[model samples]
Target: MIQFMLVDDESIIVDSLHRLLEGQEDLPLKVWKAYSADEALDLINIIEKTEGQGIDILMSDVMMPGMNGLDLSALIKSRFPELKTLFLSGYSDYTYLQTALHQEAFDYLLKPVDDETVIEAVRKLCLIIEEERRLKEQEKQNGMRLKQAQRMLNDELLRELLEKPLTPQQLADKEESYVQASLSVDQCFILLNGKVDQWPLTYTEIEKMRQREMIMELMVSMLQPQCSIVPYNGSRHLVWLLQVKRMDHDSETCDLPQLHWYLSEELERVQFTIQERMGLSCSFVISGHEVDWLQIGDVNRKMGELLDRAIGLKSEIMQVEQAGEAMSRYQDIQLQPQEIKKQLLALTGLLEAGEFLAFMNELRSFFETIRKSVFLTYERQSEIFITLAGLYLSYMNSRQMTTEVGMKLDLTYLTNFNKHTDWQSFGDYCVRLAEILFLIVGDDAKEQKQEIAEKVDNYIIQNLSRNLTLQQLADHVHLSKFYLSRLYHSQRGYPIYQKIKEQKLNRAKELLLQDDIKIKDVAAELGFENVPYFTTFFRNSLGMSPKEYKQSYQS
Candidate 1:
């Protein structure tokens, strides 16, 4: 029901309208009265201050002391645009109607006012206010949706820029409204050209490209090196600009040869895994020492020539001037079929058997030949990769990384997963990586285990209503209940049961802050049969009960 105020100079008129409005059922108006325009002014001031919002409707008489109804309506309208106004005047005065029009009054009733007329005017006023409120709410929602869509589009545009070189105008246009520019210097050009189509990862090129960027980002961060990477040559080439403090050629800090070697080694490792796990074929170019962005065109041309030569000879990494040296270095390498058999056998051995290290050495030797081969056979690569991964996992299991350490290899959850193709080599690489990871982390297993625990902690959140339990999760990952319990305590330094209780209490605090759901319901949903138990738990953890938490949010 809409609340309304009745104002007139006559007590009789005010009394009559108040009785009439109070008695009404359809409009169900809650009417208050004032005897004169001066009195009405006092009442309006009090209500606006106390309520901190305008009254829905103001009904005033035209002739009331010094200030008339039209004047009052104008003052109220200026302060509250949404407020509706009505005037009462006698004798059907044109002057009164004109004054009301100037005031932008909602409507005017001729004296003496009828009960039906008042009810209808109030009804119309209420509908107008409701419609305005709904429109404002819809506008707010539309604004939020527009913001979300804009952010998504911005992310997609940035991704596209990374995959291919855009002209200055295209780059500027893509980031026109969203990005802030930053300064950079030093650059190199890399051209990826070869029979890439022959690789098993035909469909995962974009993903691989993203993965490459990620490796670059992390590597650059560690090096504290200033570098900017842009895609060039229709997504088949890369332009990199790296800046550093000037240093002697022999200093590791700015030694181009050393830096190139380090980056090349890491890329080679990733490439090998991509082949073993994803069954993808790719070729890359590394700009020669002293090359800078100023030489991009020249480097690109030379890189293309090298790529063509490598494709002709069947190789993945080609140096335009150092082909003879690379071939000589790798020529004597051969497939270690015996080492391959040994690694497969070690997958069944225990951690204490020392077979894992031997297996790694064997793989390194065996891959020497395959690594240099231009015609990388996916089938052959996949078999070796799968066997190596199985062996790695065996070592991880023997060392109890999964059980005592609570470290599970979550390859799919990694952000890098979206950047690569689902190639056989990549798949094999992931499996083998997981295996060797469990073994390699053995050196600092405690620290690594703690990090993995933190990641899992973030995943749990404070949704106590969820069915998150150790036994359930253990079954999902094919681990025993005992192992899961021990690992949770060892790695996270907390009992599983305690973690669940803490999560539930946190959620209860969030619900209490909302002031919508009742405290009892929040308690019930967090697995508490009694509301008192939830209050006690919350009080214990936060030093205040749920009621106190709700008050803090309100205050």
Candidate 2:
């Protein structure tokens, strides 16, 4: 709603203008009367304070005993730049006109004003006000969207840092963008590698993210008092950089042992809180030594290797020092391909049957058997890796799927067998390759789903005119209604009912464009019992009636 105010030295003029404006019901106006410019300013202030609504238009006489309309307009222009002013004058002198023009009056009117002139001036001001409001609102929404995009970008950058090495200058440049405040590299920091344990494998992706966020928040709150923490994405783990500082000395010369002791105590508290409050256990590994700003990438790599060894040993908390000797104990053992072939065949059957738990169990058993019998020498590990790589390649070839270049290069690295820094690193590489294979091949269930989806699509196209239902489609496909619906949605990216409607509408459009088809016949052909219902559906979808659409096509 637009608010208006009228000011003049004569009380009669103010009352007459107020009455005229108040009678304008179509203008959506709130009118105020003031016998002088001082009174009008006071009224505007009161309205702004009480209702938080300012006047959009002001109509006042040009000549007055005190605070003439020209002076008043200048004050209003300075204070409320958005408020429009229209001046009324009894004199047609050039001086008064010049003053009005100088003050940037919206419009100037002679005495004895007509209702048409008053209403037209106010209406023009209202349009300007509305357009301004719309632009302001649009600007606000765009700002919010930009902020959300920047936040996502920040998270992506943090995740990339964990996976790749960045030089000190490169890291400094990224900090200059949007990550400076969140991550600081001027001080020594320790990388904490954490992974959630005992989380149900059946949880959806969204549920897992929520659980990870909860754990991350809890860990930050518990540890923030001791040091600064920055969380990064770890795919299947929670990674953080704990900035170490000392009150007595600068960050570069802080007491490293004391900082480590403080972190150890805080981590214990954090772990206990997570277990007691959230019913989940977490494993953490701290970097062995304090790292300078640029050495974070190297430290994180070391911590990752230690974390993998800890997982293999089934230990919750492990220090890098504990794995030093085990990492150096690589031995030379002979490869037995025939013996490994039997195990691989059994594992392949489990994978092809979509038995994920059984497959993982069998894979773990094979690894354990090899580890116990031999020392997992570099040569023996390479042979095992080669066998696994060949199996994966064969599987992909049978499915007619192309492997990524990075995966091919990684497999070639395994073939060279020189990149294994230790047995643990080689073992980690092997397990990662197995995961990639599982993801690439997918489960046998999805294969069956794709086949069923293809059949359903053919049926939908052929039976578009039928009154199709989920139960009817399921019967035709010879599957339960619930299972068919779920499988179809998973494979097709939408519900079965929506797909049916979409297909029906598409066919209806085709039939409507034909000159031989009647409107009522088109509706009936698509299983619509009533023509009006079909018309409404078409109008909602395309913003026009079926008849109108056909007419447009002809035109």
Candidate 3:
């Protein structure tokens, strides 16, 4: 409804206008009368005090004593912006309209106003005000919905990208601000093999997990300017990814083993001090292979097997078997291969016998020996095979791979494992994987490294739309940290990560150019949450706003 307040010095003028306007109902206006400008000011103050409840229109005579109608209109405009005003004066001069415009008055109502002009002005003012209000309301609603959606997407993205465990609500509340950069970011994951057990599963265990995660997060934070860490798999398992780690700086000063020990100690402390706490026993398995996040199901399924077989040992040495050769050929010592094979064969037997404790112990020993052998580079391919086997065993132990997830892990024709320069490493990794599976294993550490690179690259490209990292990729393709890094850099010229970013950016550009789509839609399509950041990235890459760039192309 359009409401009005009428103020004039002459009571007769106010009375006449009130009576005439009272008869009108088509123009949604409710009018009030005051004999003087002072009375109008008081009424306005009361309405303002009432929080804009009843009043919408102000019709006042110009040229009143003390506080003139122009001054009152200006005052009302400064405070009650939504109150539409009409200046009523006997004089028809440009001065009043100019002042009325300055105060943003709706229109000028000439003195001794005719009912027709008054009705028409009121009707027009009401229409304009309502339309403006509607637009503002719509804009507010849109902004709110955008914010909500952004929160949801960011939470999901960060959870996967960071490998951190966060609830949807917590993600919605977290502020995810980005660091502006022209250099593309390559996601990197570090998988550490550690078992944290407390005697009693209490809040203390949770706290211990939190502390360990925090320590790891802090260490990674030092490695990279931005990083995320989170608990995975029953809070005992942890996953970390690099957001923007300084490779050069970390390589120069980073002491990874020391950092690992620090986290281990924190884990131990919680176990010792807290009731029902068991100490944390951990093994370090780091990889920097690039793969997509969606493909993790496959990579993890394979890598989990690696982690499983890497722990626990019945033998002094863990050997990487070559394909098509007797396991005895790969044995370093007379009894080493036989003893390892015996233990491997016994694992399923023990599990079937319901020997959980012994199973865990054997598993732990296998990983310890595997870790020691994996870091050694007597034959680089052997190391790679051992690494792949360990990762596969880890997944097999975890048992997260379902038939649906298995579909993504299949080696296809696109996986060019034969072209790798580290053919020995590729062969070794494959043989080791076969060994982990208890398949017939021979050690032929004579595979090309380029073939390994090709297979890994193919997997990355196939799953580019997901959140993935080098660590996961390395584990999937079964290459050691050192071998994968050397091969990726040697083959790709730049890091394998640069290609991932270029691919994503290319897709983003194509989406931005599409028509009849909201900028928010573009961000969602590219798996970004904040549209503003998407806008910033688009502008930085294309040298103009997305909207402007699209329009330029259209023209």
Candidate 4:
């Protein structure tokens, strides 16, 4: 609604202008009358505070007692530049006309104004006010869209930096464009790879995605105070660039051990929070040492390789070791590729049939057969490990599982062949892998239904204020709308829509008990657009309007 204020010392002139504006049915104007400029200013302030926007138009006599309309318009324009102004004067003085023009008044009317002239002036000014408001709103929306686009571009750049090789100058240019704005190249940075472990095996794909996002946010919140972090979410892993400056006076020396200790403490807190709040566990691997600005990509790859190897280890925080030790551990292994292929085919068949015990027994027998043979060299053993890893990866790929599952394997033993002290140790690793595979494919039809139902319930509780639809809820958990409706009905003994309404009403009842909240605001907060509809809904559900419910609670 547009607001208007008319100021004149003469009661007759103010009354006449107010009546004319108030009578216009075509103009949706809330008219305010002021006898003097001071009163007008007071009323305008009140309107601004209450409505959160100033009056749309000000129509006042140019020759007022204390402040003339021209001076008043100037003052108002300085504060509320959007407010339109029109001046009224009895004299046809050129000086008055010049002052009105200088003040940028919307229109100047000689006093004893006709009804048609007054209405026409207001009508034209109203159109201008609306146009300006529309343009401002458009500009604000465009700015928001631009920011979202920029964030998407930055995420893409981060991904490209990890996956593709770029020249040093190209990397520097990209960093200058995106990274330098928030972080400095002079500071040392560590790239960390993170994975959420034992996320509920029952969660749907969408639920898992949401949980990963939640964990990422939790980690950022925990680490933000110490350094600037840039996180990228991938199919199976989360990557972060933690940038920090050395506080030591010497530029050449940095207390990396102390920094790692501090980061470990922070990660422990993150682990606890994720477990306590979401019933999930996370594993993080940090790059062993700080790197120069241009070496982030290399550090990221190195950390990723370390994380992959550390998957089966009990430790949650794995750091890259010194380059010499890491290089010395690598041994050239040679094996008959055809023989390994034949064995992997048999292993795949066992895993496919969900024969967990038989899969372990067969793996032990194969390792025993290999150990007794003269061909079980270090290179041959590593080849066997790589082949087995590939077979498992292929199996998961066939079932549309992600590569992150590889993290559950004891790859650390693969890198350090000596750690596989005997055939039994390798057999133990195979047993663990079989167990995870069994869990992934073990659930029956009824169990799957129950899992979907629980996911739906969790989504509803998390978004009670959102006026959720069945299709929206189904899409969130990757279920068909029809199937989800039937499942939810069978599990809860009620329709899904009814459950949504019940939850909203129950939440509304709780909120209405608070004295400070307004009934309309509560309705809006609960996703109701019309206050009357909300009132009716409340009365129908609880036998009382929200206001009455609040009053009763107070009583």
Candidate 5:
């Protein structure tokens, strides 16, 4: 039975209400009676401490001696926030009290209340409490089921099955979760890996979350009824285990070569659709043969190896068989694919960080990536070496020194990836270029030029009253007048002299604004030859003399 409390200043009223409520077995309430608010509060403290619960309903008179119904209700609610309160007030008191209090509900019975009205109000509150209990129980059960579903449906389970040799029980778990029903029939799964070339740089975390879901939905639309699992573990990559929906499987099962082409073509549509709809340059590498459930780990590793090389590469699509040269070369030795991938991927970062020693150490494995690349054309390879040489030479001249790097080592490999015909000699020359980047300490010559241009503008502004010449500006940033002029023009797209003239003109007009300052004084303050020279300069810029411009402003 739910607990109830009744409070009134009169002893007879409290006693009558308590007996009246307790008699209704259907509404079943254990009623507590109190003649005053203080007595009601004292009884509540005992019930809370002893029964480990609070009163479910509290009904009290609005106007009493020490504490009225409104004040008592607020005090009890602070302890038990969900406690339901009903006020006992006359018609005049109820009208005024209703506006003063706004709790979860403003419910009450008027003074001289009938017995049926008291029973009905308490009955309604009990039903509401019971319904809330039912919903809370339902939500708890649903939450447990959702957690179990998330564990079963996540990509971790898919990865574990593909990457490790599972125990029989583990195998049974995978089967029960996704494969048990299909065990009676023949099935083919193609492993396809996709990498988003660049996530939208401008997207906020919330927008990117929505974009990922939309892209996955697009992929599922094309592959469903054929796809068993696609678990994207919130990486830059998406891995799908696509079960081929083949009708004529009897002959197609043996034709692994033809099957490879067919499966890859189907997966390519997913790539094309995402590229078109989402505007993300995604690269993919499909498994070249039908994947056996037991042999999944082997295929996954090979695909991962090829993907590692293709990841930083532009919109590249390939299969295992396409990289025949690298595969054949590796057969003669343990290729250490992971090491080669790290060496290749590290070049851009190593160069940026100016890590000369690290570059030299990894040069051997670095060359291995270029030599083993199936997609890099001879022209592209030549361009790669040329670009590296240019970066080093550019750094050398950034510090005003142009020195030839190689005498003994052949530099022709700097023209082409295979030109020197000797890896050690080529690497030796490249090491010298790496040395240039390390020693300079300043990366990106463009950024260095921008800094020089900014300093020129600041110097001209700060020393405007002095000799604000091009030579002085160049001297400020430690560059020659000729080179500084060229550098500033490259960054700002205007001549340095034009910039100085504009600054002097703007300053002349500003200084001329003061009523106490004369034209001659303004000219001297702006580093002009005389008032005549400053007047000529101002008239040429604004088609008005400085005196006339100041008068126009004053008007």
Candidate 6:
């Protein structure tokens, strides 16, 4: 609502002007009137204190007895530079008031002016104020969008750092991404993976984000070190990169055993805190030794593997054994961890896209690589099986198809890797699972398209009188507007918006048949901007005006 203040020496002018603007429904005004400049200034302060708002527009007499309109305008302009100003004056006073009114002020109304002239000037000022407000709101929204985009970019880069080595150019450029992520390349650091245990499949994306953020904050507060957290997308895991050497003291670099013991002690505390405070348990795995940044991709992937296979316990803190010690036997056969995860992620993407042939081919190649390893052992096979099974189970849960898929296919491999004594046995099971997944995906696509089409048709029919856009329909179906448009066109054999116009035409015809319904009301009910647009539409479509259509229908 615009706060309008009118000031003049004459009581009648102030009272009449106040009433005229106060009753304008379109303007949505709250009017204030003052008999003198001093009173207006006082009221401005009082209203500001009481309402927490300043006058939006100030209309004052040009020639007053005491401090004239010129002095008040100058004060108002200096104090509230954003407030719009308009002047009221006679021909004789115009010359006197000329110097006081800035030429750029909102246009003035002359003395002996009609109420319409005063309102018209004020109306123009209101439009300017409203437009300014709109632009400011737009700027705010744009700023928020920019912040969210930057955050998304940071997340993507963080994922890259965990999954692959930086290119030579990135190192030469001295990329700020690692710095922004608080990972120091010149120093030793530890990577920790935490998996929030037993996250319900129904927990939405937004809920998982909230929980991850909360857990991140809890860990940061307890650890009290330079650290950064990156939560895995579409999964219940969060990774933390923490500096190994605390810089608070000269002799504070953590020795290997001390660092391992420190991490074990601290992470258990963190886990206990989670169970007690948040009623959740997160299983964790931290690197056994301090590692360099260049090996982060491999270290992170190996840590995740250690956490993936827990046969007997849940929410336990496990550490990767140092590579030269317990890991020596498997080191020769260990595939590049980053490459393994990359192909695994691609496998999930292929499944999502319903590329059954590609999925099977990728699955075959992945298992074959594991089988071909001369040093491949039962333990290594168990880890590979667990990771692959986790991926399939996660996909099924995300689609809420776990129960349905389980009923048709044996999912025992997901938990019991020991049953599949050889890679070939497990590979065959995966192929069977892929066959079912493909069938469901194809059928699901057809079902989804039909459901979306029905929803759009029903919405258009029901909300004929309401303004509707492609975005609204897309939002209802939780799809992008462009994708929804393409889907609708594909499924219904017409553009979605074309259906809206057609439905409006059909609804208009139905409404016109009722004699008591006015033509303009029919236009309004059909969501037309005005009667003429409706008339034009009716005549163009049916070769008759809405009135003509009504008359002919009555006959």
TM-score, every prediction: 0.26, 0.38, 0.26, 0.36, 0.37, 0.33
Where does candidate 4 stray beyond 4 Å? 1-150, 245-258, 322-555
Stretches of candidate 1 off by over 4 Å are: 26-28, 144-555
**Pick by TM-score: which candidate is best?**
2
Better of 4 and 6 by lDDT: 6
Candidate 3 TM-score to native: 0.26
Write candidate 3's Cα lDDT for 301-332 as tens digits: 33433433332321211111211132233344
Clashing pairs in 6: none
Give the winner by lDDT. Answer: 6
Q: After superposition, how far is residue 336 of candidate 2 from its true place, in Å?
A: 11
- Runs in model 3 with CA error above 4 Å? 48-54, 144-555
Query: Which ten contiguous residues of candidate 1 have the minimum total lDDT?
Result: 178-187
Q: After superposing candidate 2, which stretches have Cα over 4 Å from the reference?
A: 1-153, 171-179, 245-254, 312-315, 325-342, 345-555
RMSD of 6: 21.3
Pull out the clashing pairs in model 2: none
In order, candidate lDDTs are 0.54, 0.67, 0.50, 0.67, 0.62, 0.69
- Would you list the rank order by TM-score, best first? 2, 5, 4, 6, 1, 3
The TM-score between candidate 2 and the true structure equals 0.38
Q: Tell me the tens digit of each residue's lDDT in model 4 across 340-445.
A: 6687778878777655546656776676555444223344556677777676667778887645455444455544544542344555556556555644464524
Q: What is candidate 2's lDDT per residue for 1-555, written digit by digit as tens?
A: 777888888665576568777887777778888888888899989988987877778888988888988898888778888778889765444467667766767777655344566777787677666656764686596684574455476777776676678786777777665235455555566778886644542233444565676687677767776676777656546787777544444443335566677776677778888787656667787775577766667777777655543322322555555555544443234225576778878877876665544665677677655654422333455566677666556655666654552433356645554444333344545555444443445454566568778888889899876767665777676554444665676677777777777888898889989999999999998876579768876886788999999999999
Model 5: which residue pairs collide? none
Q: In every candidate, how many clashes are there?
A: 27, 0, 71, 2, 0, 0
Q: What digit string (tens of lDDT, one per residue) describes model 5 on residues 431-496?
A: 545543433343455565677778888887887777455546755765444445556766778777
lDDT of 1 by residue, 235-326 (tens): 33333333433444343354455556655665565456545533545556666655543354555555654443342242256554665575
Residue 258 in candidate 4 has what lDDT? 55
